[model samples]
Target: MRNYGVVIPAFNASGTIAETLLSVAAQTVRPELVVIVDDGSTDDLASAISGTELPIHLLRQANSGPGSATTRGIAALSTPLIATLDADDLWLPNKMERQIAHLERFPTTSGVFCHWRNFRNDRPDAPEAEAVPGWSRTTMMIRREVAETVGPIVDPPGGRGEMIDWIARVREAGLALDMLDEVLARRRIRPGSLSYGRDPARDRGYLQVARLAMLRRARDKAGSG
Candidate 1:
């Protein structure tokens, strides 16, 4: 059996941390370890998981932002298979089982991602915000070697676009990414989320990542020629 761990990057997420932890605890295929990196949160994030019996490892660092926090958590875990979860999101019960199965079925792929539904934070019971499902950081399960090869996620100047940059790197590396059609997570659309609103700085950061990806691809093609 493959050992798996989960990394959750949280910043002042006291209100949603407990629920997020509960969702992980409820997974049909539970992870061997759950690591939470608290990025200089003033809130009582520790208290949020104190009551849970889950095997959670908590790490704290200065206000370095979500990209740094997630990178730290990934480095701290020794599991061969790793999954990432946002502190404000919820993973469905079969999320781990399905993703792991997909990886096993497609051994050539470096990672597997599943669809996710977006819901308004205030109205969880209401219809999903987006008609079409999509993939996010929380919906991805990747192998350790793949993550190491892709390198650490970039911490953009505005604290967003880390996942976007990482995905671009993955593509540039010619990694085979397998996508599962099933919806495996619920993404909460809240006011203060990292990707809540558009900002010019974030857009510029994405452009930089895209440019880097293009350069990498060009270099690869030249080397092959």
Candidate 2:
């Protein structure tokens, strides 16, 4: 099995983080290191983390958004492979195992991502395993070079669209990423979550991310020409 580390950016996720950690600990191919960046949570995050025995490196930073937290967590990782998970998400036992195998089979791909299904907070612990395309960071297992090449995730004004921006950069950098047609992650949809409710601010942030990508692409093309 390949050695990999996981980064989980958390902001006041005390209620759900334990379950998320449990899912990580339960993975068939467990991570060598788990970094949790606390974005200035007032909640009892320490208590929530005490329930897990996984190897954890905890970092505390003042109320930065998830993008900042995620960037910091990635900086602490030294493994060949890196994965990201939200503080409120869950992973199937074979998630890492399957991703590792896929990466090994496709040596040229920069990373591998799987599909995910959304479940409500009050729904059954195990929702239907079937899923649609999950192009989110939560389902990604990327090589370390890809993260280094992409650099830090860019935080948009509304604290959203950082992943979109980073993924755009990755593609622009000529790194190829592959997505598996299997479901390996579970996204919990709940009130107060970043993506739960549609907000005008989030919409604006996404647009900003797209605009930046377009500008970058045009600049790269002009330089090449």
Candidate 3:
């Protein structure tokens, strides 16, 4: 079994933190270390997750946005392979196990991602079997070094679509990315979420990042020798 590390970056996620942690603890291929970057949550998220039975690493930072929080979580990882999930998202039973098996089978493939289902908050929903237009962080795993080498999801407050930036960078670096024909994650679509909220500004930020990702891809492909 591959000793894996799972990173979760959260802020003011007390409402969903416990459920997320429970889902992680229940995974059939549990992570050796699960680190939660509590980005200055105002609630008792730290206290709630701290006493869990599973081995967990919690880091507190001064609300630096998801990009910075995710970077810190990645830096703290000790395993060669790292998987990430958001506080509002959840994984099916064998999410990591299947991803790890695929990686081990295809050594040249630097990243593996599976299709994810959209859930209404914690309520379960059926998986979207088809591949989406682009990759999302909810269903992805990659080598630790490779992820950092390609560049992580920075440029935050990238709002709803920041993941596109990182995914494009990995492919731009010429690392093969493949998708598994299975569903292993449930992406929460809560109405109050920053992405789904009333703030049009957040949506505009998301659009900017999405555009930036496409631009980066074009540049990288053009630059390819």
Candidate 4:
């Protein structure tokens, strides 16, 4: 079995899937396994992978939502460590090498999330910025065991914010998390991207995440009080 695995939940990512996998494939510590889950993509995404030189595991399922697709990928883990890269993001060449070193020092830590530049273009020198105040899902290197122990990824309706809920759950369960100072990933922002793009429907995703957080807070308080 490979020492590391990657899971990319893609839906209609015909434009970005190739570059995304290429970025991971170019890593200094290449992932031992690469799993791309097609969430009912109605595009040439399958054809795109057919041309790639990289050997990756492919799985197709109905359009159950991005979160659900990610859940399926998580369920397929067969390595001790797993990394996640979206079909639209790029990983810095040394992203994996550095994150793995961090894990070496913090063996008790369940995952490590690094900082990333958010850019809207493909320019290698494109000026970019990280999420202000904190890091988000764009940067993550997780241990497979930790993810399994926390329960599978939830296929919640809040496609974008499902990560926040999942991480919150992991933290509340006493799993240690480490943040690296290096910018390990590049987030490509397009006009129709779920989190950064215009969306009246996506607004509800945030609300759902916030509501869940509030409920968790209340439960924590009640337990303490």
Instruction: Evaluate all candidate structures by whole-model CA lDDT and list the values in order.
Output: 0.85, 0.90, 0.78, 0.78
Q: Give the clashing pairs for model 1.
A: none
Across residues 63-160, which tens digit of lDDT does each residue of candidate 2 receive? 97888999999999999999999999899899999999999998999988899998887563757656887788799899999988889987898888
Q: Which candidate should be chosen as best, given TM-score against the real structure? A: 2
Model 4 spans > 4 angstroms off: 129-134, 223-225
Clashing pairs in 2: none
Total residue pair clashes for candidate 1: 0
Error of 4 at 202 (Å): 0.4
User: Rank order by TM-score, top first?
Assistant: 2, 1, 4, 3
Better model by lDDT: candidate 1 vs candidate 3: 1
Model 4 reaches what TM-score against the true structure?
Answer: 0.91
**Across residues 87-139, which tens digit of lDDT does each residue of candidate 4 receive?**
88888899889888888877888888887777775664684654432245557
Query: By descending lDDT, how would the candidates be arranged?
Result: 2, 1, 4, 3
TM-score attained by model 1 = 0.92
Instruction: Please give, for residues 1-225, the per-residue lDDT of candidate 1 as tens digits.
Output: 467999999999999988889889999988999999999999999998799978999999999978898999999999989999999988889999998988888888898888888777855456474544444679889999987898787787667667877877787788988778787788888997875768786567677766777888899899999
RMSD of each: 1.9, 1.4, 2.8, 2.2
- The C-alpha local distance difference test score for the whole of candidate 4 amounts to 0.78
Q: Candidate 3 overall Cα lDDT vs. reference?
A: 0.78
What TM-score number comes out for model 2?
0.96
Candidate 1 segments exceeding 4 Å error: 127-133, 218-225
